[model samples]
Target: MQDLLDKIVAEANVTPEQAAKTLDVIKEYIVEKFPMLGGAVENLLGGNN
Candidate 1:
């Protein structure tokens, strides 16, 4: 998770908080669109499954 956040921060020129929020939005979108993959995504992305 930290690795991804660091990449996003560096590539997007965004702050840590912004990168985190972007990840949250992406997580929510994925879970909403593909409910069955929610657990997998959470596990991979460091969230409560």
Candidate 2:
């Protein structure tokens, strides 16, 4: 997750905090819409931490 945040910050030129918030929103939506794939999505996002 940290790595992704960092990459977003670097590549997208966004702050780390912004990156985290963005990911959190997307993750929440995905989990809500696809409950069964939540675990898999989390893994792809880095992990279920």
Candidate 3:
């Protein structure tokens, strides 16, 4: 998770905190909209699914 966050921060030229918050919002949206695919997305995002 840290690795991906770092990559995003570098590539997007954003702060680490901003990257993290963006990821959190995206994760929440994905899990909410696609309830059935939540586990798969969570796994891909490095969550314990």
Listed per candidate, the RMSD to the true structure in angstroms reads 2.0, 2.2, 2.6
How many clashes show up in model 1?
0
lDDT by residue (1-49, candidate 3, tens digit) is: 7888999999999999899888888888888898998988778886631
lDDT of all the models against the reference? 0.91, 0.83, 0.84
- Runs with alpha carbons beyond 4 Å of true place in candidate 1: none
Give me the runs in candidate 2 sitting further than 4 Å from their true place. Answer: 44-49
Measured against the true structure, the TM-scores of the candidates, in listed sequence, are 0.92, 0.74, 0.79
- Put the candidates in TM-score order, highest first: 1, 3, 2
Winner on lDDT between 1 and 2 is 1
Query: Candidate 3 regions off by >4 Å?
Result: 47-49
Residue range 1-49, candidate 1, lDDT tens digits: 8999999999999999999999999999999999999999989997832
The candidate, 1 or 3, that scores higher on lDDT is 1
Candidate with more favorable, higher TM-score: 2 or 3: 3
lDDT winner: 1
Name the TM-score of candidate 1: 0.92
Clashing pairs in 1: none
